[model samples]
Target: MSAGGAHLKDEGTRRQVVLAGGAAGLISRFCVAPLDVVKIRLQLQVHSLSDPPSHGSAAGPVYKGTWSTMRAIVRQEGITGLWKGNIPAEMMYVCYGAIQFTAYRSTTEALAQLDPHRLPPSAESFISGAVGGGMATGATYPLDLLRTRFAAQGTERIYRSLGGSILEIARHEGVPGFFRGCSAAITQIVPYMGLFFATYESLRPITTQWEQLPFGTSDAAAGVVASVLAKTGVFPLDLVRKRLQVQGPTRTRYVHRNIPEYRGVLDTIGTILRTQGPRGLYRGLTVSLFKAAPASAVTMWTYEHVLRLVQEMELAAEA
Candidate 1:
């Protein structure tokens, strides 16, 4: 590997990596949309998971657990309910994947030139992943906010369609509305992605040697481990980001009524701690872990194989 970077030396190869990353994102999003929807529902709830607001009966929380939530969504909102915000979600994933991989590849290549010997592989991976994740999060933040809004709404439709949601935000919250939780998102994603890639790269060699893993390939297993670990570490920030994004007039439309208004990041965290306790910050973490495992597996598997395929095609074209 020269200072210029290994496989990404050429424009053609870099383009291939970007496309592969996009495909990986698309596939992963489709596979885990239901878990994501459930996760958001649980995150937005004001009450504890174990207890529900007494509505004059022994009814449990609207979303109790992963399986129960899935059942509830299916029963009330039909099968498609699980896919509430999939349209914007998919768009965000594709763009995010493309931007993230390319930025990561570029950043690593640059680091190779600047301080290849000085920086450890872990540090390089962390820096590159943080750059990539930050770029992706910034570029696709609006879509992310829209996806959250769509997912937050229940049987009572809030912003109806994607275009309508955009218009509603524009009408009320203005252009800045699209970037509502972007700071929190970037803060959460930067370190999370850094840790994710650092962990993945660190574990990949060991995981690959294990022949009995579920995917028969080490990357999938490594991805699962990395994602679960990384997600757990940054989950509270993620929950906060979701809460911030759902602020404004749209909050009234969501099923989780009576959500306390947050002034900013610290205030939100403080409010959660004061009102709901530390456990409240981890709301929906169970479903998030479930979503993270398969999403990471699919993402790593797809990105690797697709990149290989594209490289092979490029070589064949040259040959």
Candidate 2:
């Protein structure tokens, strides 16, 4: 390849794949932001609707299941309430997904050059995904905090805008507050992403060869399966992460505490187990699954399609 050809090849490098992945993540997230809002609220409720109302319940706790939550949000705050934090939430997830794919692709490409024979394709996929998710979590954690806070905002409207919320968090908890639950996030997301890529990649041949479908179709099918598996496995850690990040003086269940609300990750885990049992850790599992299944399919398909198109264009230009 000539110098110009090499440069053109760089256009389709893993770094640029981040752009395609980000676009895919953004559109997929927008498709399911409302479901995400419901999932976050449900996770933050502090009490289980499955059990009878108790002291820790969110006031009357009228919002119970996913359907009831959507209905209550619509009834109390209008249809728009269901999508209150759509912008920030989409932005956060988009960046997260983009960074994830970028790191995954980059890591795999780099590793293949070093020790291609030692690690199988499935193992490579898992490692790349794990690294990608951890890096993305660390890089975009503050945005995660803001997005969660935005989604958690309900009828009381404690947080009027994104800037106001950031200022308040900075004032109260300082810069570190932005990364409160980062450890939990990384812990959960690392393995979650690892299994996701492993499963998806492993299924590729099954869908493409056995089913004789197109590449995008195979990946979408695989993505749905990966999504369900990853979400279900790490849901408890996700609940803990949300609880740690969302502490504040609000009318909701996450009312601010004068002191450090949760001692640490384990303490938070134990508290939930004691208070709400296993069910507590899975507060919004239903809504999350509902959102994840389609979101994963769409995101995978879109990413595959977009990346292929971009690479094709790059190749054509080089030609």
Candidate 3:
């Protein structure tokens, strides 16, 4: 989610970068929490998103589409259901943003020093993005798993509280449970981030030529396009990660659904293809794009503005 960081020529500016990164993440998460909840539910459902409820049909889906799923969640679990995993999600985003931006900046510097002439700018951006995104995803993966489990559950709650969920995973599934889908997550995130930063950087200059776009700046517009493209490219892996996160002894806790047990990433893909067809891999794609576009745009725009503000404050103090 990081586009990069402000120039870190000094320790003071470095600190500002971290602060701006965290603020950007919190703001973005708040804007897209509901969309995130819908996307997760759609991804985890075994039945197709369009399938309506039917007593006779075992394959009947509880969630029909983005709006329908939102309505169903409200009907079954109240309006707050849309923010079921907000706590961990916010925490994860904050940590992810800080780590991602710092890592991206550091990695980019390292790459520049390592082979500035050999590596192209796009390749550097791609590599740096991959490293940064991977670090953020790995560090915050437990929280991510918890967020998914929370969002995946319905009125029939599985693990009540965050601490309880942590203990439950530790006790039943052992430590590895926390990272059930980490492989798929990292696999998806690496390329996703690389593609995002590369695409955004490539498009930013061209988009800036417009100059009159009202919503934000060219950076934000580029971010929106980049995120949508990246999310679409690696969407199946994202679905696999969500499905894996909900697996374990509590798999059946989801209401009005029958979740199958998957041995691993490949098995999960196979099951989805066998049961729901190719579309299953992209079950929640529409909602995901809805989330990705605005989330990335907001993050990029906020990060740039906040970084400028923070750096200005730092300069004021020094002066």
Candidate 2, residues 1-319, lDDT tens digits: the string is: 5332221113267755887889888889888888988888777776557646433333444456899778877887788887877777777878887888888877876766653244676777789889998998898899888888777765566668878888888898899888888889989989999998888887765766646665548878888988999889999999898888776444233321111367669998998888778887888899999999999998988887888888888879999
Clash list (residue pairs), candidate 2: 248-256
Q: Rate the local accuracy (lDDT) of all candidates.
A: 0.88, 0.77, 0.87
Listed per candidate, the RMSD to the true structure in angstroms reads 2.6, 4.8, 3.5
lDDT tens digits, residue span 33-140, model 3: 999999998888787655676442446877778998898889878999999999999999999999998898788778756532546668877998999999999999
Off-target runs (Cα >4 Å) in candidate 1 are 1-12, 53-60, 115-117, 214-216
The sequence of per-residue lDDT tens digits that candidate 1 reaches over residues 1-319 is 5643432224246889799999999999999999999999889888776786444222445667789888988998899999999999999999999999999988887777764354777888899999999999999999999999999887889877899889989999999989987889999999999999999988888887887776456889889999999999999999999999899977766867766788778999999999889998999998999999999999988998888889898889999
Instruction: Give candidate 2 misplaced runs (Cα > 4 Å).
Output: 1-11, 51-60, 210-216, 249-260, 317-319
Clashes of 3: 0
Q: Global lDDT for candidate 1?
A: 0.88
Off by over 4 Å in 3: 1-12, 55-58
RMSD versus native structure for model 3: 3.5
Model 2 residue 241 CA deviation in Å: 0.7
lDDT winner, 1 or 2: 1
